[model samples]
Target: MTGPVLYGIPNCDTVKRALAWLEDRGIEHRFHDFKKGGVPADRMDYWIAALGWEALLNRQGTTWRKLDDAVKAGVTDAASARAAMTAHVSLIRRPVVEWPSGEITVGFTHDSFKQHTREALM
Candidate 1:
């Protein structure tokens, strides 16, 4: 909660890569595994408030793709999306990081990660 808290399933390729990136850079962080520990509703609420449900939702992922058309269509707004994300944790984007600066980012990108950790690196 203090430094950086990275939330994702460890086995995910993107999550694994992000973890490696953090480790290789010596960036201290706490990892919250969605598989081991279910998504925290409070934190999920915070993420929704900060980043918006659309930003956290992974509609392009296999989970979403595999969902029934009715289920997919049910996710029409924040409340619906939250329900979908909560019901199917995989629907949430990978590596939702809460940075030391209180910035929340969904997903990982090399440049974006570098930018987010610039101060910590400095």
Candidate 2:
């Protein structure tokens, strides 16, 4: 389909909401569940490059809070960020949408997703 792949944990509330939004709008998408199918290191690297480490990491989540201090301290660069995300996929944020055209977006808000859905339909 023309839409991008939507990656996140299935049980995450944000992910559930985003999925419902897409389904309601009849937007085509492929899902990648973090807990079932662990995130690929290469894909994490790509997202880090495209969206920056700060954008890709979900600091507001419970997963991040549970990280050991040493691990949290080690996240200083793209490689370090990738390592941290690989170790704790939940800290990589929920609902990372990778557009077919190669854009990587993190997080989900109804307005933001609605705009993306419109663009994908075009």
Candidate 3:
């Protein structure tokens, strides 16, 4: 079965776990390393449109925590959030899986992955 494009920093524990889960399940996914490849602006735009910036942004992460107070404060709406995410990809959630069927998901969870797979298979 065709898998999704899993985008995240390799060192992130969440991303590592997601990758391990895929490997353990004999799933094939394309890994996009944020550090090396940088965020794809067009893909980001699509995700922002579909998921909304609030849903895609990782406000609880260290990256968001480390941002300047002003920068953090500036992300008040979808447009601002997208701008912030464009400037700092780490602010975007991890393991953003763009499935073979063009469905996009943020974050990683067993149930979520299963659902995505089911949707793709359909």
Highest lDDT: which candidate? 1
Per-prediction TM-score to the true structure, in the order listed = 0.94, 0.91, 0.90
How would you encode candidate 3's per-residue C-alpha lDDT over 2-63 as one tens digit per residue?
Answer: 78889999998999999998888787789999889999989888898898888899999888
Cα RMSD for predicted model 2: 1.4
Q: Per-residue CA lDDT of candidate 1, range 19-91, in tens?
A: 9999998888899998889999999999999999999999788999999999988888889999999889999
Candidate 1's C-alpha lDDT?
0.89
Ranking by TM-score: 1, 2, 3
Q: Rank the candidates by lDDT, best first.
A: 1, 3, 2
Better structure of 1 and 3 per TM-score: 1
Q: In terms of TM-score, which candidate is stronger, 2 or 3? A: 2
Residue 106 of model 1: what lDDT?
Answer: 82
lDDT of each: 0.89, 0.84, 0.87
Off-target runs (Cα >4 Å) in candidate 2 are none
Clashing pairs in model 2, backbone N/Cα/C closer than 3 A: none
How far does residue 117 in candidate 1 sit from its true spot (Å)?
Answer: 1.6
lDDT, candidate 2, 1-122, per-residue tens: 57768999999998998888889878888999998999977788787777888888888889889888898888898888887888888888879998766677887898888777777667
